[model samples]
Target: MRYQIGPDEPVDVAVVSAVSAAEECAPEALPQLTEAVNPDALNEIFAPKDEGPTRRSGTVSFDYSNSRVTIERNEYLTVEPLDVIPTP
Candidate 1:
């Protein structure tokens, strides 16, 4: 994921793990909600309205890549093994 704090601000980037159940050995599912652009707009739309709100300035854009979701199951359905694995 890549993030831009502002036009002149620093750009932050990272790779996010999208898996929900790693213990089951299933491929990580891509996040349902990814890539937040123009958090300023989001803040305006969802920003809290209360006293003593800390003031901050800056815009951030989050870039994300979608991952595939895989299903796994045991032959005996005993939940002993998980079969799905994500391949990079």
Candidate 2:
């Protein structure tokens, strides 16, 4: 599954939504994203900047809701079953 995050949307929100879709469950039913990663820190590293240009390149990947969630700044977000995510 894949999702594109809007410039103003919270990364955590997108993560929850994407992960929920992958898990075939409601967003509210999924485990807290904080259990997988620090939402604040994740957003901070990828968030659009006020003093400089927006970030266009970076990757943050972790396990969430039994899926592999990977975020590409300003590019795309991907979610897949954990087993499919090659060990790296």
Whose lDDT is greatest here? 2
Looking at candidate 2, what is the lDDT of residue 33? 87
lDDT of 2 at 13: 85
Best by TM-score: 2
What would the C-alpha RMSD of candidate 1 be, to one decimal place?
Answer: 15.4
TM-score of 2: 0.87
Q: In model 2, which regions exceed 4 Å deviation?
A: 86-88
What digit string (tens of lDDT, one per residue) describes model 1 on residues 1-88? Answer: 1121232321211112222232222334434333433434533433334778643443322333332222111000011112332335
- Local distance difference test, each candidate: 0.28, 0.85
- Kindly give the stretch of ten consecutive residues in candidate 1 with the minimal lDDT sum: 71-80
Report the backbone clash tally of model 2. 0
Candidate 2 displacement at residue 43 in angstroms = 1.0
Can you list the residue pairs that collide in candidate 2?
Answer: none
